[model samples]
Target chain A: MNNIALGRYLPLNTIINKMDPRSKILILLVMMITVFLPAGFIGYVPILIFIATALYFSKLKLTYALRALKPMIWMFIFLLVINVLVMRTGTLLISWGWFKVYSDAFSQTAYIIIRLTLMIILCTVLTATTKPLDLTLGIEKLLKPFEKIGLPAHVIAMMISIALRFIPTLIDETNRIMNAQASRGVDLENGTMTEKIRAVLSLIVPLFVSAFDRADQLADAMEARGYDPSATRTRYKVLKMTNVDYFAMAFALVVFATDLVLCWI
Target chain B: MEAIELEHLSFSYDGQTDVLKDISLTIPKGSYTAIVGHNGSGKSTLAKLIIGLLEPKSGTIKVLGQTLTDHNLKAVRDHVGIVFQNPDNQFIGSTVADDIAFGLENHCVPTKDMQRIIEESAAKVSMSDYLNAEPTNLSGGQKQRVAIAGILAMSPEIIIFDESTSMLDPQGKASVNEQIRKLNEAKNITILSITHDMEEAAQASNVVVLDQGTIAAIGTPADVFQNDALMSRLRLDLPFGLKAAKAFQAHGIEIDAVMNNAQLVEALCQLK
Candidate 1:
C-alpha cells in the first residue's frame, strides 16, 4: 500500500534534507501565521505560490503533494458553502429569504481555500524534506533551553522519532495479523461498523500481547546495549543548517511579512 | 589474555535466590563458544553480566583483564556488541544502511569513513545490495544480518548472540550462521552465542551447558552432548546429524575418527 512511505519520506542525498529540521519547522510556523491574514486573494495567492515552490524544491511530486488536500476537501467545501450563503454582505449575486450569496463571500471562500491549501502544502514540504530523526533532533535543539525548567525536550522529541520509526512496522504487523485472522473466519471488513469493531477485538488482543512482548524484549535488548535514555549520548549524525537553509527560511519570512503589509495596506 | 573471564558469578533480579549461581567460566581470545540452556536457566544472564548489562550479585567478571564495573560500563560496551533474540528490538535506524551505521555512529566514526564501514559490514553479511532498504522491508534473516552488521561495524573484541537466530527459518539461520563463522574465522573476533539449537552449538569449537543458573557442563560438543541426563536437564537437544553418528557408534561400528555429519559419512563410506 506504500504505507511504509508514511514513515520518514525524505530523499536521502538532497541538500535540503541536510538542513537542520528545526529551521524547516520555523518556516512552517511563519507560513501558518500568514495564512490567517485578512481575507483577500492578494494575501492568499502569494502563500500558495510560495508553498508550492517550497514543496517543489523539496523533491516531492506535486500530484502526491496535493493529496494533503483530500482530508480537507469536505471542510473547504463546507466553509465555502457556508460563507457564500450565510454571510450576507456586499453585492448579492443571489438572495433567498434572509440568505444571500455576495461577491465578498466569493472572495472570502477563495481566501479560506487558498490559506488552507498553502498551510497544508507548507507542512508537507517540511515532512517530505526532513528525516524524522533530524526533525526530532531539531525539535530537541529548539526546545533545549527550556530543559532547565523541568522539560524533557530531547526525550520527548526522541519519543516522536521512535513513534515515527515504528508506525510502518506496526502497520505491516497489523496487516499480517488481520490477513491471518481473516483466513480464520474473522469477518473484519464484512460486517456492520459495530460488528467490525467487535471483529477487531480479536485482532487487538493478539496485537496487544505481541506488542507488550516486543516492548519488554526491546527494553532488555536496549538495556544490554547501554541504552540509557537519561544518559547524554554523543550524536553520530549532526544536523547543521547551510547558507541555503538560511536563505530558504529568510525567503519564507519575507513572504510572510509582505503578506501582512498588504493585508494592512 | 582471556577475552571474557567469569568466576563464581551469581545473580538474582530481586537479589534473593540466585538466578545464576556459582558460575565460573573463561573464554579464550577469538574462541567461538556456544551456550545452550533451557528457559530460566541463566544463559542470557551470563552474557549480560559479561557485557556489564547486568551487575552480578557476587563473584567476578573480567573482559581483557579489566574487571567489570558500573563505571566502566560504557568502556565495556565499546569493546563488546550484542545481538538479541528478537531482531525487531535491536534496530535503531530506519534503513538497512542507517542501522548498520548506528553503532559506528555511536562510536563517533567520522562521516567519510562511516559510508565505507557501512558498505563493508553490509557486504560481509551479503546485505550490500539492500543498504537503502527500510528495516521494516527486510525478512527475519536479513534483519539478523543487519543486526550483525551493526555489531560488526563497531569492531568489537567480542560479540554475543542471545538466541538471535531462533525466530529465523532454516535457510535464514544457515545464511546467518555462515556469515558469523566467517567473521569468527577471519577477523579473530570472539563470539559467545546463547542458542537453543544444538546443531549450531555442534559447529562451535566448544559448548557451555547451563542449568538452573549453573555451569552443568563445559567441553567440546561431543563431550557435552553425550551426557544424556545433563543434556536433557539443560534442554540441549542434540542435532540430528550428531544423533545419527552416536547411533552408528552404538552399533559396534568402530572408526578411527569421527566428528560432524561429513566426518561420520566418510567413516561409513570406509566400510566399502
Candidate 2:
C-alpha cells in the first residue's frame, strides 16, 4: 500500500500542473536544443540559470531532479575525461610519455559535465512535473498536424499513453506472479545464467496467459460498447495554449539564441 | 414474449464432441434468470453463446427482438454485456478508471463525457475512490467491482454474469449480489446468471439447469431445485436446508420450510 501510495500521481493542484502538456513538451524540446547550443562558459551560465528557473516554476524539487542524474554520473565523468584529455586543441599543461593535458582541460571538463548534468535534470523535471497521461495527450495534440504527412499520430499517442499506464500495472503483476512462483520454489533473482533464464521463462508464461485472457475480455467489453478504433475521438481535457505556455517557449528560445550568439562571437 | 430466445444451439471446439447439444431456452424480459449446473454441465457455454462470444454450430439467439448473427453481432453485442467468472480474466486496464474507459473509448465516447460516465460507473460499484487505483492492487472483491464498472459503463440492455461471484468469499459474494439486485431494479438490465450456488439459484426469478449442453430444467429457482435426482446426476451439491427438510420428512416428521435457516428451525421445532 505504501509502495502504491508513493508511486501514484501526486495530482498537484498548481498552475504548472494545469498547463497544457503540449506546451510543456515543446519547452522540453527547446531545453534539449539548449544543451547542444552552448559553446563556452558565457553561453553555458545562462542555460544553467534557465534550467534552475524552470525547475522552480514547475514546483519540482531540485534534489529530485539531481537524484535522477545519479545513475548517469559515471557516464558523464567518462565523457568529460575523454573529451578534455584526448582532444589536443589548446596549450599543453602537462605532457607524459603517452598522455597530455591541455591548460584549458579543467574548464572544458567542468563545462561538459555541467551541461550533461543540466540536460538530465531538465528532462527529469519535465517528466516529474507532468503526468504520463497528460504528456501523452500533449504529444497527440502537438502531433495532430503531422497526420497530413501520413503519420498516425493519434494511434501512436494512444499507444504511448496506454503503454505508460500499463508500466506500473505490469510491474505489479510481475511482482505478484513472482511471489506466487516463489512460493512454488522458483528462484528468480539468483542462480546461474541458464537457471535464471529458466526461472524468468516460467514466470513469463503465466503473465502472458493472464494478459491474453485480459485482452479477450477487454475485446469483449470494447465490442459491447460499439468501439471502433478507426474513428475520430474527442479528448477528455481540451488542451489550450495559454500565456504561461508562451512564456515557457520564449524562455527556451532566448537561451537557444544566446547560445548561438556566444558560439558565433 | 422472450427477451432472449435460443433454439437448437450446438457447439464444439476444435473438432471435438459437442460441448452443448441441441439446447433451446427462453429468458423473458425483466426476469432475473439463473443457469445452474455442476462442473462440465455446459452451463458456461450457454452464457457465452447468449453474448455472441462463441458461434453455435446450429442455432440462433434473439436478444431484445434482434437476431444474434454475424451481420448484427456488433449491435447485439452492444446491447448485451457480460461479466466473466475469473475477476482477473475481465480486467484489461491497469487502473479501474482506465478499465471502464476502455469500453467507452472503443465506442468513441467523447473524452469529457467518458470521464463522467467512468466516474459514475465506478461509483455505482462503490469503486469511485479507487478510480485511478491499479487493478492488480485490488482484492478479489475490489477487482470484481472494477469488472462490474466496465460492464456498467457500456450501458448494455442485458448483462450476463458467467459465474462471476464463484471466486469471492461469502461476504464478497453477498455484496456483489446486492449490487446486482439493485442495478436490476434501478437500471432494468436483464440479468442471466450462470451459477452453481444453490443459495444464489434460489434467489433468482428463473433458474435453468443445464446437463450436457441441453436444458435439463428451466423455471423459477424454487421450481427447478425441488428435483434432487437431476442435480445428483449433474454432480451438483444439494442445497443444505432442502436436503435437511427432506431428511426429516424421511424420518416421518412432517415439516414445512422455506429457504431461510430461521424458518427451518421453526419447522423442525414443530416436529413432534
Report the Cα lDDT for residue A217, model 2. 68
Q: What is the C-alpha lDDT profile of model 2 across B198-228, one tens digit per residue?
A: 7776667888888776788888655666666
DockQ values of all predictions: 0.42, 0.39
Per-model interface RMSD values are 2.6, 3.3
What residue pairs are clashing in model 1?
Answer: none
Error of 2 at A173 (Å): 3.2
TM for every model, in the order presented, reads 0.85, 0.87
lDDT of 1: 0.80
Question: What lDDT does candidate 2 reach at residue B264?
Answer: 76
TM-score (chain A only) for the predictions, listed in order: 0.88, 0.87
Model 1 misplaced stretches (Cα beyond 4 Å):
A1-23, A55-62, A80-109, A137-153, A183-185, A190-195, A230-232, A240-247, B13-18, B57-59, B108-113, B228-235, B250-253, B265-272
Prediction 2 global C-alpha lDDT: 0.76
lDDT per residue as tens, model 1, A156-179:
976786677677777778888999
Q: What is the C-alpha RMSD of each candidate to the true structure, in Å?
A: 3.6, 3.5
Model 1 residue A155 CA deviation (Å) reads: 2.9
